[model samples]
Target: MPEDARKRARRRLSIARGHLDSIVRMLDDPEVYCVDVLRQIKAVQGALSGAGDVVLRGHLEAHVATSAGRGDSVELVEEVMEALRYR
Candidate 1:
């Protein structure tokens, strides 16, 4: 993985962790605002989405591109297809 991508993933994960902790605390409080909880959930989802994007970008740039350059991208394409089948 690229250093920059790794850093971004780490940052996103950190934010996700904080969001999860807040959610846990909110669960203990009877008067927690629903909007605040929803906002935190959205923040966590966005962070996770960003991390997924980083992983996909790295896979495309390093694995898929290299496989294509070597004229043997079939396996990579097949793997992606199989993964997408469940979606």
Candidate 2:
């Protein structure tokens, strides 16, 4: 991956990790409302999704297209599709 894309993705993942840590803390707090906790969980999900998008974009731009000339592009594309489908 390009340095910029990798840095951006890492930042996103770090945000998600912090959000997840908050969720765990909320779970342990007796005063936390269910709706508020759920909202935080959704936020974390969105952050993670954003990170995934960054990684996918980087893979397509930096690897898949470059692999086309080497004859492994189709396999890589299929792998990406399968991963998306399962996710």
Candidate 3:
């Protein structure tokens, strides 16, 4: 992965972790609002998705773009397709 992208992904993951910890603490409050919790969960999901995008872009730039030259274009395409299916 490119150094800048790797750093960004790590930062996004850290934000997600902090949001998750906040949610856990919020759960201890008996009067916590459902919508507030949902919002925090969404924040965490967005952070994770951001990280995924960075990693996927890095993988494409570093590996997929070279598949044809490496004679594994078909295999690489199939692998990426399978991964994207669940994404």
Best by lDDT: 3
lDDT value, candidate 1, whole model: 0.82
Between prediction 2 and prediction 3, which has the larger lDDT? Answer: 3
TM-scores of the candidates are 0.84, 0.84, 0.89
lDDT of 3 by residue, 1-87 (tens): 788889989999999999999999999999999999999999999999999988888878888999989999999899889767756
| Candidate 3 Cα RMSD after full superposition onto the native fold (Å) | 1.3
lDDT of 3 at 37: 99
lDDT ranking of the models: 3, 2, 1
Per-residue accuracy of model 1 over 48-71 as CA lDDT, tens digit each: 887777766776677787896798
* Alpha carbon RMSD to native, model 2: 1.7
In angstroms, give how far residue 2 of model 3 lies from its true place: 3.1
lDDT of 2 by residue, 4-67 (tens): 8899999998999999999999999999999999999999999988988888788778878788
User: How are the candidates ranked when ordered by TM-score, highest leading?
Assistant: 3, 1, 2
Give the C-alpha miss distance for residue 47 in model 1, angstroms.
Answer: 0.5
Please report the candidate that would top TM-score against the real structure.
3
